[model samples]
Target: MERKNHIILSILAILLAFSFQESRAESRDSLFFEWYTTTNMEPWKSTMEQMAAERTPDNYNQLFEVVLAWYGYIGYCLGNDKEEEAEQYLETGWKFLDELIEMNPTNAAPHALKSGFYGFEMALARYKALILGPRSVSTLKTAASIDSTNIHYLVEKGNQMYYMPSMLGGDKEIALHHYKHAVELMISDSRYHQRHWFYLNTLVTLGYSYQSTEHIKEARKTYQKIQRIAPNFKWFNEEVWPKFVEKYGTF
Candidate 1:
């Protein structure tokens, strides 16, 4: 009878542990989506810091989450014209990312992320572009060579092409092609389309590119697709859509 009771107690303990793990996973997912849709950085940043502090050797994904959250926070600061804050976050983010890269040099994602960070830094100081530009291009090329289909690498390449001056080989047509290829890659992976914030942002970039090129119909269709997928995206619903309507007369 004592042995039977012990076995039952062990089962209950196991069940409780499983339940706790499941709850934590759900909470993390919810927090990620909330941050993605609303750009509300504080809550997500707190959660990521907590997760990172608790990370074990087996918790690689948690570490990646922390890095990705930092990336998002940097973007948020830059978008709001907080250049100093953005640079601060960028430095901290690079500290973590550089460690990860050293640990796993062949992983393409970190390389892609580092490449993007260099580009962001260049944007903040165009004078530094002469030095940082080659670094950005080289890192991205390394990432692409390692994993040609990596969505992040593709997006960075597209962004470079989109923003570079025509004199420096920036072609809107080629940029569109890269963006389209990235979208197609994401579409083929349901997990990316459903949950990845970067995938959605890539779509937004593609839409704006279309608008810039005076492809109104395509731009409106892209925006409409974003609305259908994530109506809570404030930038699209509040800013882009209104400006688009004002300029192109409501699609």
Candidate 2:
């Protein structure tokens, strides 16, 4: 009888422990979702760190990927000129992602993120032509090998083709092809698959490509599309419109 009672107690203890663990897991998952949705990256970083402390290396790879996604979000903040906070987040997030990639070389997401990282870094850099040329193409080609269907990859490749110097093999027609392909992929979604910012970027890139190739009417139409979507996005006024007018508007 005593032996049977001991067995019952052990089973109960195991069940209780499992229940506690499940509750903790749910709490962490909820916190992660909340931080992600609200763009509360600092708190999200802390939560990921705590989770990393208890997780094994294999699981930590995925956790680190989530952290890297925040890097992209924080990059958006940087676009808004939130430089100080963005720098801090970018530094930490880049380190975490680098480590994760070093540990797991086969993962497709890190390769994709690297393509984005190099692309953005060069796009915003001072000497963009000299610096961002080869690295961006190489990383993006790797990402393409891993996930060809990814719309961002297609768009980025298209952007490079449209804007890169002749020696770098920039082709305006190829760029338009990729942009159209991206649009096709997103067309079936209930919400435009290219969200507001992405759509804005696409229009700007397309307009510049067309303008570069001396297609003035096409450039005007694309810029008009952006105006319709966001009458006040800063890029529209300062970057796109000015360039469009300088190149194609009635002079």
Candidate 3:
């Protein structure tokens, strides 16, 4: 009786361990799915780490495309200082985007991603915009048309609207409306990080818009709120405000 009882306890312990491991694995997978959908690449770095561990030839090409896209985006966010890395990933991302577009010309995702890549390149190298603005604008329009149901595509369009001229139908009011719509649609997603990022970006955009229209007090409040929320935020402190100061020279 004593020996049988001991054996049962040992089996229970083993089962518990297996269950815990499986639960952790599922949690990780869920996290990655959220990141991939929301375009949040920071914490999703672990997914790339896992891909590196299982670098099979059959999966390598797809993995490379994703990695390039993520890195390209990350470097883009890092601002003008990382120009070299940004350019490298921009090139890599375009190649992959082109391949994906060729494979499925009507697929909305590739066009959306391509539009973003071009926009990032324009931010990093202003001259690129002079050359590629028309192409990027066309691609973004196609992306929105192709994926009328995806809020992400709409949000991408909203972002493009901010930079485009009035002749191109880029209206700040329309952009704000769409940004609010995106936040409403995606806020309840289990992806907290992605939601958080969207919130932050929206805040920044709103703040800048207020500043642009001479709402100095409102912009100052927004900037102060950003500092309070993310005191060490990379772009907010370093790149964004400096550019603002340079442009208005007293704001």
* lDDT (Cα atoms) of all candidates against the true structure: 0.81, 0.64, 0.63
After TM-score superposition, the amount by which residue 77's alpha carbon in candidate 1 deviates from its true location, in angstroms, is: 0.5
Q: In terms of lDDT, which candidate is strongest?
A: 1
Measured over all alpha carbons after superposition, the RMSD of each candidate to the real structure, in angstroms, is: 3.6, 8.3, 8.1
What are the per-residue Cα lDDT tens digits for candidate 3 across 31-75?
Answer: 554454344666775564454456444443454445443643554
Arrange candidates by TM-score, highest first: which order?
1, 3, 2
Candidate 2 lDDT for residue 117: 64
lDDT of 2 by residue, 1-251 (tens): 99999999999999998788666755655554444334455776566556546655656545553554455456656676776666666666677667777777665556656666665565455487466667777877886887776666777778678767767687888888787677667566432333333444555677777777777787788778766656655546776588668866643
Candidate that beats the other on TM-score, 2 or 3, i.e. the better one: 3
lDDT of 1 at 26: 59
**Candidate 1 lowest-lDDT run of ten:** 190-199
Residue 85, candidate 1: alpha-carbon lDDT:
83
On TM-score, the candidate that comes out on top is: 1
TM-score of 3: 0.58
Give the winner by lDDT: 1 or 2.
1
- In model 3, how large is the Cα lDDT of residue 135? 77
Considering only N, C-alpha and C atoms within 3 Å, which residue pairs clash in candidate 2? none
The clash numbers for all candidates, in the given order, read: 0, 0, 0
TM-score winner between candidates 1 and 2: 1
